[model samples]
Target chain A: MSLLRILFVVLVAYPVVLIMLGINVRHRARLPRRGPAVIAANHNSHLDTLALLTLFPLHRIAQVRPVAAADYFLANRLIAWFSLNVIGIIPIRRKRERDGDDPLVACYAALERGEILLIFPEGSRGEPERMAQLKFGISFVAERYPRVPIVPVFMHGLGKSMPRGEWLPVPYFCDVFVGLPLKWRGDRESFMGELEQSFHKLKEKLAAPEYL
Target chain B: MTRLSLPPQVMYALLGAVALLIIASAVVLALARIRPERDYTELKLRIKTWWLIIIVFCLAIAFHRDVSLVVFAFVSFLAFKEYLSLIPTRRADHRVLFWAYLAIPVQYYWVGIEWYGMFIIFIPVFAFLYLPMKMVLIGETQGFLRAASTLHWGLMTTVFCLSHMAYLLALPDDRNPAGGGDALLFYLVFLTQINDVAQYVWGKSFGRHKATPTVSPNKTIEGLIGGVATTTLLAVALAPWLTPLTRIESVAAGVLIGMGGFIGDVTMSALKRDIGVKDSGTLLPGHGGILDRLDSLTYTAPLFFHFVYYLHY
Candidate 1:
């Protein structure tokens, strides 16, 4: 097992699993229990990290790596070890700054390995309800690995569960909805355009009164 | 002058929390009763969130007076968060932006530890090097120039600028416990807000010529001069009660805050013009989001902090 996968189970995924059940976890989309899939989420809170994990039985999976920023989580040796190896996070350098080449390469490597990669299409995390401009990185990777199914994931009630800077996660019962896996038809631009629309469609699905 | 020998902080933030919450909640309730709530849920949520933050700040200060500085740091973090969320940022610069985000807490940490020498320039000089280096490393030949500049601008506007006020509490003074930081906070905040109100009222009531028509149409020279004069006179009278500054020094402080505040407002107005928004957020009942409340402080905090640091620290 990759060090990143172990860290994910022990540190991130465990707490999420415990909390999801604690909050009476339910899946409206009713995703399959097992699969090699790529889950993309809305960008908004730091807690959005664990919020997505609440939907997956992460421990059962052997190869899953969530893409995180190299600057924040892996800026130092200790945090890097925890984020990159233990938590099963692939540190990709954000192309915006002058320093993100290594992480982008790592992301490509993880996809080639057939890992259950978590891609944040909107890039920076925070507002799961709104879809802003998304980086084509998810599409870029998917274009290379056509077999990997890209799943549109959205979490309701996360904005209140843990806002920015509040260390303690509030006892708000948030729900997660994973849409059907979106299969790419091989054209990179068309796939990305469709994926962006899929993200909004899932958000609209979660935003309905039934999910609340 | 008598100085009280208490802990590092008196930790009266709980008192402040209660006062602010009642005030904020009352405003929200009154607004909801008078206006349609459904049309403005977004505004209500923002205020509620601000109220929650204030409550958390109070609890943190009351519990750990020694680390009450964290509360101010947290405020800066929120203000920065709100500011960045509205501003457009590209993915190519995410690595350095992360550094910029982390810089919020670290900048406030320096204020908590009272490290002025580096805290003063952490964003401008060091962050300048760090942001460029991060961008350079990405090796993306295109958009580096624009992205790098925006990243630098965000850090300067948000963290470096906002952290100055929190640093004021660390001012080396012989007057009171907490080094009169609370007084400095009240004094500056009160002055900035009053100046804003006074300018708006004066502009609305009187005057002919616009201050800058393009940058800020609501601003008028008559309003600026009248507000500054009125705010300066008020500071002269209020200084002895709220801050340790002398009456003359208080007048100077008032003038500084008044003028600095106008500049900050116009600067934000310019950005808003670019982004095309009338208010930063519809959070406060009559007020806007954290950005609206903080816009003046972005310019005033650093200007005022540096003033006291030179004359009073």
Candidate 2:
């Protein structure tokens, strides 16, 4: 809603999304019509959030909140401003998880408010070729709101485009695979396993020649 | 200098282009009606794109010189982006790529100020040396030669070659023959494009032997000759109004642009072949990408610039 953030998205973020990322948002029709839903994607680069946020329908963007790590997103005043306001990121303290604080609390509140919470369940950026173990935080939040749909998203090629440790991004084609959403059945372990399996299936489907 | 004035030749040429487009549209419409079952989607989309391109380009050149430069600057930026996106690059070369993108504006800035010295040397001298030096500091020589060559090639074709059109527009009003800079710009674009269409038509009609079978099978010796001859004749007809060249010199310039246009297109084809892409990108609906639309300009722009610059400037 901030004027500066809108300007930044239009002038800076959209161009980066189009030219640098070459983002293809596939299965857009599968995105839940409304929220109190969770959109979980594999983390590969910093661009994944921007790509997904931009891919979300513009009218419903205000209700889309991305869950970002506190240490990374809140590292500075500028980044924090961009993350908090521009991206509407719900900063969760990943490092301070054991300090009697539940990171899922903020996410749960967001879902309860009918906000679409975008969380990278891998907890951090990982290799694009493989998906890491899904953090329990995602399933935990989904169980509290069992009716909510958890959409499995697979991002292709952002890791090489603007991976961690690279100050500048190279132009690379990236595809965002939005799969059908799954509802929580209250079994955290099986839910997480199914979520991971869904990601693998999405990745395989995208990699197949017929999809291209 | 009548800075805001549009030359009579430019006005007349634009009118002619509009007339041609309308006639072409009618013909295509008739063809669609006659052959309703055949797919005319791609052809219709190409014509639609031509309408937009003609309007945008003519409007750009119709404005003040600096505004036109900005339009070309934007084109260069997109072309460069498309080229880089298709090519392989390393993480270490990201900073250098940033500099390469920055060079687009700076190169056009030279045209804005008419600084020929810096415009000519900035990319070749400063960018050429600076990219490698920056890569050396990164100290990753894994794909060093391949990376450096691709970066330089992207800069040259995307920024350096494409910027020549802006520079041609920047030529002093008095030195650019009777129709001045605007006419000259339109002349080059019009002729180069017509040359492309001519080649396609000729190739389709009478093309026999493949020019470069492996590199570009569609190009043929017959097409090349027919295209050059057609362009040369058109050049002589439009010479007095569009360019400073005398009739004979216009014929020579026509040959240069015609051949250069073919070479540039096939060069891009070879690049697409090397990279194993059918099209550079899908920005333009039927044209595949900006690179696909402007490939001939990559060669024709610089060749025409130097030819004019040598004769007049």
Candidate 3:
């Protein structure tokens, strides 16, 4: 099957059928899931990815490309089925030495089509207390499709539940935060740094609003 | 036997007085935070205002007897005005808005004449054409973009849409006369409002998580389910006494209204969120405004009324 079509069946169809069966689904943001959208979030837990998998009901936004680590979902069928079919995982090879790997090129192409792409630019999961600096992937994708708004998301306390494979996540309700959409200017380095700070600010906002 | 006495007409006279008292008391309860001094004065003014409304309402009930639709038409007019005031429109499209105003009567006129075909087409097709032509006549030259949008919204908000409230005035079914046309009005109104109230109640009581926290924080699964459950039960019980519906039929009809009402409420809510406002206006105290009351009605009125008209009528 084609890469794009396979991704559609996975990201859009699977979770919808799950929701109809009553899987305790909830959508957090007030924003419209339509038009050019960027779902960028903190890369803490696997739930940061799974939560988005169930967000859309309308079939128009079928292809959701998750920027995934090559180390995690590279060769396993369970992960591969999730990546290719349900979640539409776009594998990012971070070796920096591997030739002909072009994951960023794939992401840019998806963005141009006005597809929903989930990117976590903390590079990798950080220590529990602190938010890691964001990678340039968000800015890179934003630059490619400047019309789309990069929406910042924060998933709290997800990493505490089975971080890096204990088989099952302990069930406890934690707040999910989706901030307002941010428009990207031409500057890449500054935008990346801003996005990093943006994610941290979201966490602070979730814990307790600074204004209050 | 009670009819033999002259007290019924007197009792009917007291119906207006009773309605006034209930409304005044309800408003007092809703604005429970008002200070005692302001409260008494507000209550007095409220009674006076409701006295006018209640007199008009009771007078229509007493005199015309079959003019419930006319009362609803007035309600629709108020609702349309509230909606038009809130929604932004281009100033160049005055002719379109004028035609939209013209549509209010034309649609109700169809109900008056019982011309279902013309009534249905009057807004969506005819108004659609007439509006653009009106815009083009002025020949602003550069304002076409704004002109087109304003004209369409005016029709949607004012004319093509609101006429359903008038259509509902014709709701007294052949099967039951006791309920009268006002029963349909009561059904549409209560169903819409209770759905909103029920959602809030359910959300507050059992809401473990947010459904659309960013767009609407109050919406939750617990609320949606609870509201539907409560409204469904209420609809089943109320529909039989109020309309020509049976126990099962009432359940089915209520389910339709409950779900349809929710969609209409959410759609209006999303629109408000997009515009970043709470209530449409303060036209009606404790209810926000006329548009706030009418949002669900706008979609619900036509929906249930048409459903009853085609299948049940």
Please give the RMSD to the true structure for each candidate, in Å.
Answer: 12.0, 3.8, 22.4
A best-first ranking of the candidates according to their DockQ comes to 2, 1, 3
**Selected candidate, larger lDDT, 2 vs 3:** 2
**lDDT string, candidate 3, B99-189, tens digits:** 6656776677787776778988887888778777877887765767655674466467545565665665554444445354556555665
> Per-prediction TM-score, chain A only?
0.77, 0.90, 0.76
- Model 3, residue A201: what's the lDDT? 74
Which of candidates 1 and 2 is the stronger one according to lDDT?
2
User: At residue B158, what lDDT does model 2 achieve?
Assistant: 88
For all candidates, state DockQ relative to the true structure. Answer: 0.05, 0.28, 0.01
Per-residue lDDT value at B202 in model 2: 92
CAPRI quality band, candidate 1: incorrect
lDDT of 2 by residue, A72-149 (tens): 889999989878988888999886547777766888888879999889999988653356777888877867788889
Can you write out model 1's per-residue Cα lDDT over A1-212, one digit (the tens) per residue?
Answer: 56456566667656653432222333435454554567787765666666555555656455656788777887788877767555667777776555533336676666566566778887775443345688878877777678767877766555444444544443323446567777879788888788777766766643222111
Instruction: For each candidate in the order shown, give its overall lDDT on alpha carbons.
Output: 0.65, 0.81, 0.60
lDDT digits (tens) for residues B148-190 of candidate 1: 7866776787678877766766666465333366566656766
User: Where in model 2 is the C-alpha error above 4 Å?
Assistant: A1-12, A15-22, A74-82, A95-102, A126-133, A142-147, A156-161, A166-175, A182-212, B1-3, B282-288
**Candidate 2 - CAPRI tier?**
acceptable
Clash counts for all predictions = 29, 0, 5
Over 4 Å off in model 3, which ranges? Answer: A1-212, B1-70, B141-146, B171-173, B282-288
Q: Each model's TM-score?
A: 0.57, 0.88, 0.48
